[model samples]
Target: MALNYDKIVLFGDSITQYAYNVNVSPFCLGPALQDVYTRKFDVIQRGYGGYTSAHAKLMIDKIIAHENTPTSKVKLMTVFFGTNDSTGPSSTIQHVPLETYVANMRYIAEKCKAADIKVVFIGAGPFNAHQWWPTRPGNPHNRTTIQAREYCDALVALGKEIGVPTVPMWDLLMEAVGWKEGDPLYGLEELSAENPLTEYFVDGLHYNAKSYKIEYDGVMNAIKQAYPELLPENVPLRLPEWASLTSPDVLEKALQ
Candidate 1:
């Protein structure tokens, strides 16, 4: 039988889904990880656009079971949600109550814990309503920075309570654009075209290459600190390197 590699699962909504090819660049988190982990461990993406925490909880079992088997175990999992979960009621079909969001997140952590997998939470990723407002001019705004922060903060606190480390995507992006706490938000289309927020965001909602680099750095740093053993540099390739083979017999033996 072929060798089965260990797994690193990225579970979340559209952000996770889009990480591989956002803005037509593989510089995003998913591909960056796979590049580093090419022969060490497989990176499995479970991103679902429009998925809420409740949806994540429901899907966790399948995700875990898919990799956390006897042969190929899941060593790490990034639970990235809350962007869609932060949607206000009557705004999007994916919205879940804050309390429900907390409960669902907890459920996902518990599942990963039971499987002996290390979990990292990435949440409440930043959003710019002013930049996003044009998408739905007359309709109710589906999400805002404040609401996203509400859920992200809750998730951060939840991570603390659950003893899991969290990567603060929302805060990092906000700070990148120099957003100070207690700053008043502008109405739709209020920001100047030259606003710093325009640099990291595409259409005020999706991330471009620059912002994705932030995400890649955050994930690598989190792993470097919390689970150094899983770092790409530290992990050995499962199979022998082709250049290391001395003879045809050695190569055949290594394969066997």
Candidate 2:
């Protein structure tokens, strides 16, 4: 298919916002943004902190209304949420009612389609109480592996119905680590000792640096796989050499 728009907007929660404030190589989605479209596409991070899909629906409409100029067009957009919804007291591991999650995603997909914007949906990643050590007894803050997997499956099914691409973020994370001891989600190695080993959030809700990298990488990989025509050849698939030269803490400071 031919390229659609000149701009790519990233829409989601804190995970999408990490790139604007962090330089931890993995946490940064700027590289991926540039890679997908070279200079032709500008990746704008429109993610809000602590937002669920319910909130993202508003953000999307607002962005479209604000930027709906004659020359403006959105080629692509990605939406990721559900962590917050899963953390609610009444929420089960299966998430804030699987039906509700599907409904929210469908709503987003419909609006994007109407605008002629390609939409990509990402499922929630795996969360293991056994892997993550920083959780309460009830695992109240985090969803279980079973729950995460089921939610992702539901999202994927929704993607099929809506005829949009669905990136399996949860599957990618599981393939990358899969409850491994040294995995950042639950790893306790000296390298990750200073930083918390929990999946993404300091409290199991929001994301930290490590989780940011994992999610960003997964999202980029998905974009490349599904929309290769939209990306430039010179753009890198991995972090640049310089990105690894700086210490994580120093990189974090620079972003501040």
Candidate 3:
């Protein structure tokens, strides 16, 4: 098929990769956006599991094509990262220095802006360690909610500094899940399946169905505020609506 549609590219980590997963108990982020846009824009996912901003910078050129390239135009790009990047000292591979993370984020925003792509950043970290710590695979739990919050806060400010819009996932999730700093965890460690956060998180990090819904809501709100013209409801379909085709001639004209 010809690439006949403009796209909304979701470029980030595992969060982006799983945005369209109906198996995640339905109500997925990417699919919700795609459904609303339908024929107007393709929702492209470029999420890399375990990738940090440094890795993203290392592979930037390959991930984003130049304008000279013959391909569908990318109307908007949502950069959702920072989960793994928020890892603590034990995470030798995933731990990106705060300054470096900021620099990498800047590089990403600059490149996309130069390409004339509308950008939005989604800061998806500063996770709940109470839920994630016990599920760790090794000697040290490499991430903590405190450390994640530091990185998430940095990204939010960085977005404002660079004129790119950012969706503050940490704060949004905290409010949605109703947990915050210094709040007593239900346990010392090892959260049960039915903790205060189970409704939104699968493992204290990855999102469950409800979290994706919250994400979709925030994303749509950001688009409506910053790029209202790009909102799915505001965009026109690539083809005429079926009910509008009263005759073969009308259909032919619409196709042209």
Candidate 3 per-residue C-alpha lDDT over 1-256 given as tens digits, one digit per residue, 9 for 90 to 100:
2337888888888888887778864888888888898888888888888999998887666766742145578889888878888877678988998899999999988888887789988886436656676666665867666677778899889988888888887788777657666775432245444556656777778887888888888888889889999998787778777898889988777666
Model 1 C-alpha lDDT per residue in residues 120-195, reported as the tens digit of each score: 9987767766677776678776677778889989988998998888888888887777778777443224445356
Clashes of each: 0, 3, 1
> lDDT per model, in order?
0.82, 0.62, 0.79
Q: For candidate 2, lDDT tens digit of each residue in 109-148? A: 8888888777778777655453444545554434555566
Of models 1 and 2, which has the larger TM-score? 1
Error (Å) of candidate 2 at residue 191 is 22
Q: Clashing residue pairs in candidate 3, if any?
A: 126-148
Q: In model 2, what lDDT does residue 55 have?
A: 73
Top candidate (lDDT): 1
Span of ten consecutive residues with least summed lDDT in model 2:
187-196
Q: Which ten residues in a row have the lowest lDDT in candidate 3?
A: 185-194
Instruction: Write the candidate numbers in order of decreasing TM-score.
Output: 1, 3, 2
All candidates in order of lDDT, best leading:
1, 3, 2
TM-score of 2: 0.68
Model 3 misplaced stretches (Cα beyond 4 Å): 1-3, 66-71, 137-139, 180-195
**By summed lDDT, which 10 consecutive residues of candidate 1 come out lowest?**
184-193
